[model samples]
Target: MYLFILLPVILYILIRKKSFKKVLRLHKVSPQQIFITMLLILAIQPMTALAARIMEHLLGHGFFPPMGDMSANGSGNLFMSLFIIAVTPAICEEVFMRGVVLDGYRHIPLWKTAIMNGVLFGLFHNNFMQLSYTSIVGIILTYVVVFTNSIYPAILMHFVMNALSVLMEKYPTSLYANFTIWYETNMVLLILLAIVSICATILLLIWLKRLSNNSAIESMDASDNSIEASDALNHTITFVEWPLMLATAISVIYSLMMVYAM
Candidate 1:
């Protein structure tokens, strides 16, 4: 919480001397917008699952367990597990990624910003198995925040994704599990399903973008730009910064250690 949430808030306040909410992109979004965002994330599941499953097949099963499963055990109840595995990360990570990180990259074009944000997020995880799919999801989440001009939709999307994972983990005999069993055996079907899901994901994203309030997004951008002249800390940080470099190096070393240790 301190690293992802509080630290960003402190840095924003110290630098911008402005309301952290604007920098955090905390604009309010409509209910329909959030619902569509949830659907978008659900649509993305097959693709992400395919990425993870393919990597798992290549590396052998039991290599990189789901972080949620690692932390949430049978000792925890459903609510506790959900809170630990889903809710907390949704809030904390969204605040850091979609809020602080995205805002920092505002000067760049949307596509570049989203991709870079996604890459950073993937690297943040430090696990080779998760890097691809999480980066894809991170890109989608960044676009979610950008389209809706709000952080809440991304948070909801994140929660739904993780919560479903937790629920599925809890109930191994669920339909999803059955489907996964079948899916693993059918390579042709898996590829077809992944393609269809990707198409659906594209459609959902376009629909969500159309539903977004353009004026609000413009207003937010203008609001931030308006303050740039007076705010000395408005400058963007390059990737070469010592803090980012150090963090990346640590993550890589840790991931390598885990791989060799296993």
Candidate 2:
């Protein structure tokens, strides 16, 4: 976690001409925007699980084991668990992925940038199980950062999601027991929740699209000169960009090795 932040800062100092604030998108967003970001994350939770299940089915069980033996030796302390699993990654990974790496590709179209950011994030995990879901989450976080023009929303969303995971893992046996009983007792409610999640997710995407469109229009109106510069900067690059290509290749190769070795 510390390395993520530190490496990015070092690279920025050595290479990037832009100020850290601009590169990292340390801008402000409205309270309502933050609330919407939270709602969007809630809506997407079911979809993320679905993506993970799909990946697991395609890759098979052997490809992914529980990360870090968290189940065998649980954190025991709630605050420590939260600090290790939630707070640290929320800050460090976001700083590295969304702040440094995503910013490196900002000259490209937003969708392409988001997709690349997602893929890189997935590979960064070096595990099949996490790759699919984390990629999806990364794309969503990238979109949120780009649309809101701020990093706080992504950080908050990451923290919330990680905190939930920590809770789930911290008391897995208890949670599983309660879930089994609840499923047996309230199958109808479970179905309803699933249906609601699907519907809410669709609605949130529509809402986000409209919000993004409005923001784009406002940005265009605000500066024609900036738009021209943005367009000029949006040209494609080749794989001859050795640094990016090499990093991507290494990540993919290592992940494949881990998968097969399992």
Model 2 over residues 1-262: C-alpha lDDT tens digits? 4653446455654684667777678887777787788898777765566566567668777433553454333447777778877888788778777786766665455666778888878878766678888998888888777777778889999999887776666665786446633643454654565567668855765565566533533443344334464445434442125336644654565557656855
lDDT per residue, candidate 1, 38-145, as tens digits? 688768877877877787888777434664554445355888888876888788777777776676666554666678878877887766778878899999998888
Off by over 4 Å in 2: 14-17, 62-68, 71-75, 173-199, 205-234, 238-262
Model 2, position 190, has a per-residue lDDT of 46
> What is model 2's C-alpha RMSD?
5.7
- Model 1, runs deviating above 4 Å: 2-5, 61-74, 215-262
lDDT of 1 at 72: 49
